[model samples]
Target chain A: MAREKFQTLTEQMFYILLALQEERCGADVMALVAQITQNRVAIGPGTLYNLLEDFLAAGMIVQTKTEGRRRSYTLTQQGRDRLLMEKQRLERMLSDYRHMTAGTEKNQRDTAG
Target chain B: MKRKFEFNLYAPFQYQDLQDHLEKMAGRGWELEKAGYRLFTYRAAPPATVRYAMAFRPEVGWMDQLPTQGQEIYADYCRDAGWELAATWSRFPQVQFYRSRKQYPVPLETDLTSRWRVTAQWMETRFVDPLRGDVAIGCFFAIFLAIVLTIFLAQEEFAPPLFAMCAAADVLMILLVLNQLVVLVDAQRWLQQAKRAAEEGSPGPGGRMSLPWKLTTGLLIAAGAATLAVYVTNATADFGFLAPVRIAGAVLVFYITLFAAFRFRDLLRKRGGSPHWKWIVFTLVATLLALLSVELWDWFTDF
Candidate 1:
């Protein structure tokens, strides 16, 4: 079955929403994402612009202010809920990994002893 | 400034090729100044390395000369990122060319999936839809021609020369239809492959002037030439030595009228006064000029 659009966010989409958690302009959001990720994930200007447009259309983000071409955006409650849901999904996956790996390590130790 | 003009034949989807070609020209001390329908103008400049990016704005009409407010804002965003709007060409999916001013500027697009999505939308709007219309129109004409040929064949006095001319024109139309079909299929295939790569979190496919494309274009040109030859030969029987002259005059009238309309539009744009109604004005002017040219040609030929 096909999933709904934005139902499962891509890594870039996730980070863009996280960046908009606080009101930030487009370029600032881009710089903040790179800084937070320690220069690991770099968002291109075109990509950021497109994602912001989509977020605004999807009602996940709201435009807080506009100065000339510079516009600032912040995540709405819907956006925060979406981001939290994705975080929980990732946490569950991590917990499952830990549970499986811990049992495997314990069994190996038992066999060795 | 010294300038030169050349016809660009790359398809709209072949943005990579256009970008590389412009960069190569810039390295040779020529920089792009403007782009119009099938033509690029370059001015002499010092040799430099420049990165080019193509951004598509599908909302822009094919005849739109003045940029919209949204387009200006988009350019503003790109400008802040070290890219400057170099030229704009109003193809079906209107495109703007941006050149990087700084050394090793950051890429305009980074997300593979987002890039693919934008490109796919442009392709669907400009390439697939238009080609489908062309193919359908071609099929309708082919069927009409077939019916005409059948009726001619049933005549009591079958004329070999007329039949031969019809056959030549038929071959030309068939080649045109076949070329359109090939392009449609190729575009769909490219989109499918790009989609798969994007799904895998990789960059979409890059476009090139493939061999098949070249061969198809060559074949269409040859077919057109052959059809024209048959036409000239048939007309010579009725019009004496003036057949080829008449044909050339008609072609001249068509090209001159088209060029005049576009040049006028460009002049308005340069003066920064092109309004939305310019399209209608251009069309009316072109039609009048074409009619005048045709009438003058007939009078000159008769004289």
Candidate 2:
């Protein structure tokens, strides 16, 4: 939802990039999405794999090395910085929401009194 | 082996319409390979069901072998089927479903991607021969027109030497037209080879206007000009030192203009300029300018 800039990168780009940041391989990335979204969201090899291709193109994550038909992607400085920035913005939003909701709760208690 | 025929249909025809037509003739058995971009390469058709194909050309390329010649059969058929015949290259009027032993169907690929464009690079070439010859003819025509117009405006002033100049221009025109036709025939043959070459993935027209062709045409013009010069010199007043040199310089310039045009043709081709049309226009403008320059020189020197 916070991705206001990456219009062409699409919905799957963020999820795939986030998965890569966790030191996950392709299969692991697919499994992680299933576990995190409780299998409600599914990404196909053809489509999801293409997003991973975008990361490869964007130079965010590169195939650090290959091991037995398995290629691993590692974050470049750009990717890590981008992910950390997203996390910080999300955390700030969460804190703002928490304080606002607590004030709303206190106001409700006073009205009941 | 009764040489098997294959149909390579490349077009961007209406899909639903094509699908319905293909479905109607589904029972007609032929090993089919339905590649994307509305391409369906067909093998020999069975005797039972008639072979049918319908597809549209992608923006990049097109092929239709089955053009019904002036009989209006194919046009009528396409009209009925809601198919509009795509524009074919005017130079090759024989566009439509051409019969080929399935092995020999015409290939359709992007012209820009072809090897003719990719591989044809000129390095340190001083003159464009085959190409310049064409341009020279174009310049000759323009100069002829200028000469004719200058004479006409001067109002029937056919001086003793004017007749020779006019005759020379006439001879040059005849030679140019004849040579253009001869080269045009070769161009047609080369175009046929190009169609085949592109099919083979060469991605080029696969030929060049040769040295002999270029040399002969240039010589033909030079010979005609030299003969004219001889006659003009004999008829005109006895010349000073500059007259012979001027005549020599004129011949040299004419030949070299053509050479430069041909040598640079490949470079010009890379830049997407038409050698045929560009040379023609160049010839026209250069000849006009040359004639004008001569007139200017005459005026200045007289003053």
* Whole-model Cα lDDT of every candidate shown, in order: 0.77, 0.46
DockQ of candidate 2?
0.01
Q: List, residue by residue over A1-113, the lDDT tens digit for candidate 2.
A: 22233322323555666778757666677668767878755554323434455567677888876665456787888887777776777788899998889988889999999
- Point out the worst 10-residue segment of candidate 2 chain B by lDDT: B118-127
- Which regions of candidate 2 deviate over 4 angstroms? A1-11, A67-70, A105-113, B1-33, B36-303
Stretches > 4 Å off in candidate 1: A102-113, B61-65, B101-104, B142-170, B192-202, B226-250, B263-303
User: Which ten-residue region of model 2 chain A has the weakest summed lDDT?
Assistant: A1-10
Model 2 Cα lDDT, one tens digit per residue, B49-167: 32333221111111222222221333332332333333322111222221112332212211222322112211001112344566567857756775675666467667656555665
TM-score of 2: 0.28
Best by DockQ: 1
Cα shift from native, residue B47, model 1 (Å) = 2.8
Tell how far residue A33 is off in model 1, in angstroms. Answer: 2.4
